[model samples]
Target: MYRYDDYDQRLVDERVAQFRDQTRRYLAGELSEDEFRPLRLQNGLYVQRHAPMLRIAVPYGLFSSAQLRTLADIARRYDRGYGHFTTRQNIQFNWPELAKVPEILAQLATVQMHAIQTSGNCIRNITSDAFAGVAADELIDPRPWCEILRQWSSFHPEFAHLPRKFKFAVNGAKEDRAVIQAHDIGLDVVKNDAGEIGFRVLVGGGLGRTPIIGEEIAAFVPWQHIVTYCESILRVYNLHGRRDNKYKARIKILVKALGIEEFRRQVEAEWAFHKNGPSTLTEAEVARVAAHFVDPAYESLPATDAGYASLLDENKPFAAWVKRNVRAHKVPGYASVTISLKKTGVPPGDITESQMELVADLADAYSYGEVRATHQQNLVLADVRQSDLFKVWQSLRDAGLATPNIGLLTDIISCPGGDYCALANAKSIPIANAIQERFDNLDYLYDIGEIELNISGCMNACGHHHVGHIGVLGVDKNGEEWYQVTIGGDQGNKAAIGKVIGPSFAAAEMPDVVTHLIETYIANRHEDERFVDTVRRIGIEPFKAHVYGNRQTEKKVAHA
Candidate 1:
C-alpha cells in the first residue's frame, strides 16, 4: 500500500479541519440543510433514509491489517456495529451522526485514508484490479498508477466541479477484473511488441440510464504521458459535457452524441497540445511509486499440499469452501481466499465489527497480515498458505464470513437501495433477501453454476446490473416497487450490456420471474455452456417468452 508522505498528511489534515468547521456551523444552525448539501457531499457524507451515511475510500481496494483494524474500530465506535462494502470496493457506515463525520475523517487521515472524491462530480476513487499485485496473469500491478492519479486528482482545481461524477479504472491483467470497459476512463497497461510499457486508453464508457462500453481513443499511449493524456481527456469532457441536465451530464452521453470518431479527434487535439508537458511522468517518479508495490517474499513449497488434500477429504464444508473461495496464486502452495459476504438473508458486502476483527486476526495468523477488498464486495486473504486452508476456513466459518458461494447464483451484487439510498426508487436488499430465501438450496445454486446476478436500485448502475448474467433494475411505477429484468450481460474481454427481457414485474413477483429465467436457460442451453454463452447463442427470445408470456392471463389465473 502507498504510504502517505508529509504533504499528503497535511492536505488531509487541512481538509479535516475545514470539514470540522463546516460541521460545527451546520450543527449551530448557521448552515441550512439545503446550504450544507454540497459541503457534506464533497466530504463523502450522504443523508440517507434514516440517518447519514459516510463512505470511506479504500484506495484501489488495498488495505493493511492495521488499516482493517482501524476500520473495525470506526465501525464499532462511530456508527452501527457493521459496515457495508460497496461495489466500488469502498466501505460505508449507514448510521453515522452527521456532526461526527469530520471526526471520523480525522481518524481516517491518520491511516492514510479519506472520503475525498468518494462522492461528488469529480474524479472518484481511481479503482484498479483488487488482485493487482498478486494475480498470476498480471502484466504489471496497476495500483501505483492508481495512487498517482489519486494524488493528482485530489482537490484538483481545474476539474473539481465537473458536469457529473467521473470514474477511472486501470487494469494491467490479462483478465478485465477491474471492469475497465465500464468506467468513464479506462486504461489498460500493456507492453508493446518492442517490450515498451504503454496504455490502451478507453474513454466515455459508463453504466447508468445509458450504458456504454468505452471506445478506444488511444491505442498505445506512452507511459510518460499518462497524466497529460488523462488530463486532456478530462479537459475535453469538462469543457463540453452537459450541465443543464444531470442525466445527460456524464461523458458517456457526450461521447454518444458526438460519436466515437469525433470524440477521439477532440481528445487527440487536446492531447497534442498538452502531451509531454509538466504532467509527463519521469522514470524516477514511476520507479519511486512502483517501489512501494514490490512483490512479497515467499517460501519455496510444492505445487500441491498433501495436508490440504487430507483436510478437504475429511471435511465436506471445508472442501466446498475451497472449491469456491480459493483462487490459484502465482506462488506455489499459496492461494487467494475470498471470504464471502453474501451469506443467505444478510445484506451483501456487510461485515460486522467482530467479523472485521476476526478477519484481521486471521490475516495476521494465516496470510502474512495482508487483506484485500474485492470489487465484488468480498474480503480477501491474498497469500494464504494451502496447508493452513482448513484452519482458516474453520475460523472464517465461525466468524460467519465463510459462505461457500463465490460465483454461484446466490452471490449477488446489490446496491444500498431504497432502505438507505435517497436515489433508490425501491428496496433492493429486501428483493435480494427474498430471492435468496426462495433459492436457499446450495446444491441447486451449484447446479445453476457460475451465475452473476446484479441489482441496482435505480439506473445509476452502482450495483453493476448491466454486467450480470441476470440483471435486476428497481423502478418506480405509480408509487409501487417494480423490477426490470435484463439477461446475458457480461463484464469481461467480450463485455456486453444485458437486453431487457420484457415488461417489468412487481417486487413480489421478482423471485418467481428470476426462477423462470433460469429454468428457461436450463431448458435451452447447450451442454457445458454458461448462462452468458447460452444467451449469446440462443438470444433472449426464449427467456423473454418465459417471463412475459400471457402476463394478464397468468395474473388472472393466479388470482383465481
Candidate 2:
C-alpha cells in the first residue's frame, strides 16, 4: 500500500480538523439539520434509519494488518461491534454517533485511511481486482493506477460536486473480477502487439435505474495519458451530464442520450486539449508510484505442500473448505485464501470486531501482513502459504469466519436493503436469511455448483442483481413486499443482464421460487453445463415454462 506523502498527510489532517469544527458547530446548534446534511455526507457520514453510518475507504481494497486492527478497534469503540463490507470494498459502520465521526476520521487518518469520496456526487473510491498482485493472470498490478486516480480525484476542485456519484474500476487481468464493465469509467490494462503496455478505456457503464455496459472509447491509450484521458472524460460528463433530475444525472444517461459514437467523439475532443497536459503521467512519476508495490519476499517451495495434503486427508470439512476458499496464486507454494463472511444464519459481509482482529492477526502471521477486501464482500489474505492453510483455517473457524460457501447458493451478495438504506422498497436481508435457512445443505450447494445469487432491495442494483445467475429484486406491490426472480445473468468477461422469468412472488414464496429455479436448471441442464450456460443455450423460455407452468397445469396444481 502507498504511504501517505507529506502533502497527503497535511491535507487529511486539515480536513479532519475542519470536520471536527463542523461537527462541533452542528452539535452546538449553529447549523441546522438541513444546512449540515451535505457537509456530513461529503465527509462520509450518513444519517441512516437507525443511526449514523460511517463509510471508511479501503483504497483499492488493500490494507495492512495494522490498518485492519485499527478498523476493528474503531468498530468496537465507536459503533456496533460488527461492520458491513460493501460491494465497492469499503467498510460501513451502521451505529456510529454523528458527533463522533470526526474523531473516527482522525483515528483513520493515522492509519492512512479516510472516508473521503466514499459518498457524495463526486468520484468515489477507485476499485480494482482483489487478487491484483498475486493473481496468476495479470497484465499489470492495478493498485498504482488506482492510487494515482485516488490522489487526483480527492477534493478535485472542478469535479468535486458532480450531478451524481461516479465510480471507476481498473482491471489488469483477463477475467472481469473487478466488474470494470459496470463502472462509470473502466480501464483495462493491456499489452499491444509490440508488447508495450497501455489501456483499453471504457466509459458510460453503470447500474441504477438505467444499467449499461461501458463502451470502449479508447482502445489503446498510452500509459502516460491515463490521468489526462480520465480528466477529459470527467470534464465531458461534468459539462453535459444531467443535473435537473437526480435519476438521470449519471454519466450513463449522458452517454445514452448522445450514443456511444458521439460520446466517444466528445471525449476525444476533450482529450485533444488535455492529453499532454500537466496531469499526464511521466515515466518518473509512474516509477515513483510503482515503487510502493514491490513484490513480497517469497520463498521457493514445492507446488504442493505435504502438510496441507496430510491435513486434507484427515479432515473432510477442512478439505471442502480448502477446495472452495483457496485460490491458486501466481507464486508456487502460496495461496490466496478467501475468508467467507457468508456463514449460515449470519448476515452476509458482516464481520464482528473480534473476527476482524483475528483476520488481521492471521494476515500478519501467515500472509505477509497484507489483506484484501473482495468485491464479493469477502475478506482475503492474498498471500497465504499452502503449509499454513490449516492453522489459518482453524483461527478463522474460531472467529466464526470459516464458512465453506464461497460460490454457493447460500453465499449471497445482498445490499443493505430497507432496514438501513433509505432507497430500498423492501428488506433484502430477511429474504437472504430465509433462503439460507431453506438451503442449508453444503453438499447440495456444492452439487448445484457455482451460482451467483444476488439480491437488490431496489432498482439501484447495488447488490448487482442484474448480473447474478439467480437474481432477486425486491418490489413493493400494493404496499406488500414481493420479489421478482431473474435467471441467467452473469458479470464476468461475458457479462449479460438477467431475464425475468414471470410474475413476482410474495416475500414468503421467495425461497421456494429460488428452489424451483435451481431444480429446473438441474433437471434440464445437459451434462456439466452451469446454470448460466444452460440458460444462454436454451434461453429463458424453458425456465419460464417450468416456473409458471402451462395454464392447465397451474390450475390442476392449484386445485390439488
Candidate 3:
C-alpha cells in the first residue's frame, strides 16, 4: 500500500474541512437540496432510500491492515455493524447519518483514505487486478501505475466536471481479471515484439443501459506517454460529449455516435498538442512510483510443503477451500487466498465489523499486513504462506468467511438495490440470497464449475450484470418487480455483453430460471467444458426454450 505524504495528507485534510462546512450548511437549511446535491456527491455522500449512504474509495482495492481496522471501527461506531463492498472495489455505508458523514471522512483522512472523486461527474476510482503484484501469470505490476493514475486523476482541474462519470482500469496480466474491456478507458500494460513497454489502449468500454466492449483506440502508446494519452482521451470527451441528456453523456455514447476511427482521430489530434508535455512521465518518476510496490519478504521453501499436503489429505473442507479460494503466487511457497464474502445467509460483499477486524488480524497473522478487495466483491490475502493455509482456513471458517465457492454459482456479485438504493427497480440482495440458497450444495456447485452470476437492481449495472455468464437484471413491469435473464456474457479477454433471453419473469421464478440455465449448461456441456464455454458453444436458445417454453406460447402471451 502507498502511504500518503505531506502533500496528500494536506489535500485530504483540507477537503474534509470543506465538506464539513457544506454538511453543516445543508443541515441548517442554508443550502437547499438542489444546491447541496453536487456538494454531497463530490464528497461521496448519497441520499439513498432511507438514509444517506457514504462510499469510500479503496484505490485499486489495496488497503493496509491498520486501514482495515479503521474501516471496521467506522462500521461499528457510525453506521450499522456491516458495510457493503462494491464492484468498483469501493465500500458503502448505507445508514450513515448525514451530519455524521463529515466526521466519517475526517476519520478516513487520518488513515490516508478519503472519498474524493468517488462520486459526481468526474474520474472515479482507478481500479486494477487485485493479484497484480503476486499473481503467477502477471507480466507487470499494475499497482504502481494505478497509484500514479490515482494521483493524477484525483481533483484534476481540467476534468473536474466532465459530461458524465468516467472510469478506467489497468491490467498488467495476460489474463484480464480486472475486466479492462468494461471500463471507459482500459489500459493493458504490454511489451511489444521489440521488447519495449507500452500500453494497448481500449476506449468506449462501459456497461450501463447501453453495454459495449471497448474498441482498440491505439495499438500501442509508449510507457512515457500513458498519462498524456489518457489526458488526450478525456479532453476529447469533455469537449464533444453530450450534455443535453444525462443518459447519452458517457464516453461510450460519444464513441458509438462518432465511430471508433473518428474517436481515435479526435484523441490523436488532442494528443499531438500534449505529446511531450509536463504530464509525460519520465523513467525516474515511473521508478519512483514502482519502488513502493516491491516484492514482500518471501521465505525460500519447496513448492509444496509437507504440512500443507498432510492438511489437504486430512481435511476435506480445507481441501475444497484450497481448490477454489486459493490461487498460485509468484513466490514458490506462498499463495493468494480469497476470503469468501459470499457465504450463505449473508449478502454478497457485506462484511460485518467483527468480520473486518478478524480479517485484518488474519491478514497480519498469515499473510502480510495488507488485504485486497476484488472486483467480484471478495477480499484477498495476497501473500499467505502455503504452510499456514490450513490454519487460515480454519480461522476463516470459524468466522463464517470460508465459503468454498470462489468462482462457482453461489459466489454471486450483486448490488444493494431497492433494499437501500433509491435508484434500484427491485431488491437485489434478496434475489442474490435466493440464488445462493437455491445453489447451496457444494457438490452441486463444484459439478457445475466456474460460473459468473451477477445481479443488478437496475440498468446502471452496478453488479455488472451485463458481463456475467448468467446475468440477472431487475426490471419494472407495470407495478410488479420482474427479473430479466441474460446468457453467454463474459468479462475475460474476449469480453461480450449478455443477450436477453425472451421476456422477463416474476421475481418468484428467478431461482428456478437460473437453475434451468445451469441444468441446460450441464446437460449440453461436453466433458470438462466450463459453463461459459458451453453457453458460447450452444447459444441461449436452449436455455431460453427451457425457461420460457415454445415460441407459440410466447406468441400467445404477446397477443394477450
**lDDT winner:** 3
- Mind giving the per-residue lDDT tens digits that candidate 3 earns over 9-74? 999999999999998998899999999999999999898999999999999999999999999999
lDDT of 2: 0.89
List the lowest-lDDT window of 10 residues for candidate 3: 546-555
| Pairs of residues clashing in candidate 1 | none
Q: Which parts of model 2 have CA positions greater than 4 angstroms off?
A: 550-560
lDDT of each: 0.90, 0.89, 0.92
Candidate 1 C-alpha lDDT tens digits along 263-378: 88898899999997888999999988888887777879899999888888988989989999998898899999999999998989999999999999998888778788887889
- TM-scores, one per candidate: 0.98, 0.97, 0.98
* Candidate 2 TM-score, true structure as reference: 0.97
User: What shift in Å separates residue 69 of candidate 3 from its native position after superposition?
Assistant: 0.5
Clash totals, every prediction: 0, 0, 0
Ranking by lDDT: 3, 1, 2
Give the poorly placed runs of model 3, Cα more than 4 Å off. 550-560
